[model samples]
Target: MSELKAKLFQDLSDAVVDMDEEKTVETSHRVIDEGIDAYEAIEKGLAHGMDRVGELFDQEEYFIPEVLICSDAMYAGVEVLKPHLKGDEQGEKKKVVIGVIEGDTHDIGKNLVKIMLETSGFDVFDLGRDIPPQQFVDKAKEVGAHIIGLSTLMTTTMDGMREVVRILEETNLREQFKVIVGGGPISQSFADKIGADGYAANAADAVRLARKLVS
Candidate 1:
């Protein structure tokens, strides 16, 4: 039985990493047929595969397109398992606030981070793009979020992240949340300049940093 379970998990992980939607769906069904726990399949299979994909991304082995497709497969598997995840299981979620900073309309990076964070067990409050600094602060305060992920594809919008930090500092909320910055033009140096708690090169790194930040 352990071997069978391992095989199913391996198949599911491979399907997600391969970005094979049909294969992922089939494997999800196979796990169900085998009476395997859906949460185990998600945690041990798709989530594990996504972590590898993130590493590949960090190493420059995988690019944005590949990450997108792989995340799609993982989300598909999650959709299948969503129905079976228990109420108690659902309530243990950690909240994360995410959005693209002001003057930025690009959502590709933000969406990727959102998917990766959600897959890693964060309940993300996505504020969408073109969001002002105050909006981010408001949402984070309202949701009692521990992590605030800011995405910006334009250099022009990088200042928005700084503004967010400034606003938080003024309100005694600076220590209330960890600020994580990302997007096309952001770097660890930039994060340091702006006083951000963390910076990730891609979605997976964002999840890693966010987890550490929240913890």
Candidate 2:
């Protein structure tokens, strides 16, 4: 990367980490104006910042409110960059259907995962919070999605994730799409028991796992 492009990437990352939405948006526009690759801006800039935010959250250096604010900044940058993405940058993207499972209204993690996946070049179809298992199956079929990502912050709603896997199996679609699960109460062992293809501990891991599954 050139010195100017390097600086813009750094500025974009810092803007998000600082929770400066306006700066993030402005820098994103600068990225487009300078004819930088939108994909690079998103991966090296916004996603890089969100990765740090995740680390801070893990260390308790940042709490929920701070992470949420940082996410706002990151997403604002994404909005500005999305329209400028070139066709080659978007060609043949993998499709993913993501949602917070039924009886689970908490979606901060799910939203973060969606943003990161989109920025990382996945075709994300967000089914939103409190989605039924059948809805996930239906949407995945509709979109010809390669992966079905289920999330739940509650142990009570975790069963809903299993139901999605079960429904796919019964419909003989289990072989068609990979199923990945995540959230506060989810674990790899639980995922194995529930017959999910993978389990991600957080949003960043979710992106990595999705890539691995597809590749």
Candidate 3:
């Protein structure tokens, strides 16, 4: 990369880590004006920044509020770069259907997974919170989604994730999509018991799991 291009990417990463929304937006616009490759800007710039945010989160150097702010800054840059993505880039993206299971209103984890999935090149169909089991199956079928991600933060609602797998099996659609579960109360053992294809303990792992599922 040229010195100027490298600096722009670094500036984009710094803006997200700093949670500077205005600078993020400005840098994104400059990237577009300079005809920088949007995909590279997103991956090498914004996603690079969020990767650090994840590390900070793992070390407890960053909390929920700080991560949320970083996400906001990252998204501001993404909005500017999205429209410029090449047709082939968009065409090659994988599809994911994600939602929080029924009887649970918690969605912070689900939202984080969605954002990370999108940043990692998955086209996510977010069903939001309190989604019924059939909705997940139906949406996955509708979109030809490769993965169905279910999340619940409560023990009571964790059973809802199992129900989703059961419904898909009964419909003979279980083989059509990979089922991945996550949240505060979920685990690999729980995922195996529930017949889910994979489990993610957090947002970054969710992305890796999604990629592995589709791969």
Candidate 4:
């Protein structure tokens, strides 16, 4: 039983990193038959793989295409195991509000961040792209999210991130939710200037920085 369980984990990890959709589904069933805990298989095996992929991305060893496919594999495995997840799982996960700030139509980065957060068991409320500053504050308040992830690909749109921070400050909610900033044109200096709680260069770094901020 232990050997089977271990193999199932290895297979699941391979599926995620390799982005093998069929293999991901196949390994999920093998996990059930092998008697491995479903959540363990997901959190430890699948999500862990994605996390590693994220790290590789941070190092530039893997690009967006690799990250995208790996995320797809992670989701495939999650879909198979979703039904087996505990009923109370919904309330146990952390809630996050994510969006691309105003004047930015670049969603690829935002979407990647959402996938990483969701795969890591965050309840992501994606507000999509070109969102106004007030919308971020309102959504965070409504969803009771502890983390607000802002994305922007254009330097011109980076002001939108600062505006979101400004709104949060004006609303007195700046201290309530941790803010993380990311995108192609954003830097650590930019995050510091905008009063953001954290800055990440890539999707993986975003998850790591977010965990640190919220934790």
What lDDT does the true structure give each of the candidates?
Answer: 0.87, 0.88, 0.89, 0.85
Go through the candidates in order and give the clash count of each: 0, 0, 0, 0
TM-scores, in order shown?
0.89, 0.84, 0.92, 0.90
Task: Order the numbered candidates by lDDT, best leading.
Answer: 3, 2, 1, 4
| Residue 135 lDDT, candidate 2, scale 0-100 | 98
> Which stretches of model 2 miss by more than 4 angstroms?
153-158
lDDT of 3: 0.89
The sequence of per-residue lDDT tens digits that candidate 2 reaches over residues 100-203 is: 87544567788878866775668999989888899999999998999999988778888898899999999999999999999888999999999999999987
Candidate 3 lDDT trough over 10 residues, lowest sum: 100-109
RMSD of 4: 1.9
Candidate 3 per-residue C-alpha lDDT over 127-209 given as tens digits, one digit per residue, 9 for 90 to 100: 98888888999999999999999988779888889899999989898899999999888989999998999999988789888
Q: Rank the candidates by TM-score, best first.
A: 3, 4, 1, 2
TM-score pick, better of 1 and 4: 4
lDDT of 1 at 125: 96
Which sections of candidate 4 miss by over 4 Å? 103-105
Model 1 agreement with the true structure over 131-199: per-residue lDDT tens digits: 999999999999899889998878887899999999999999999999999988899999999999999
What lDDT does model 2 reach?
Answer: 0.88
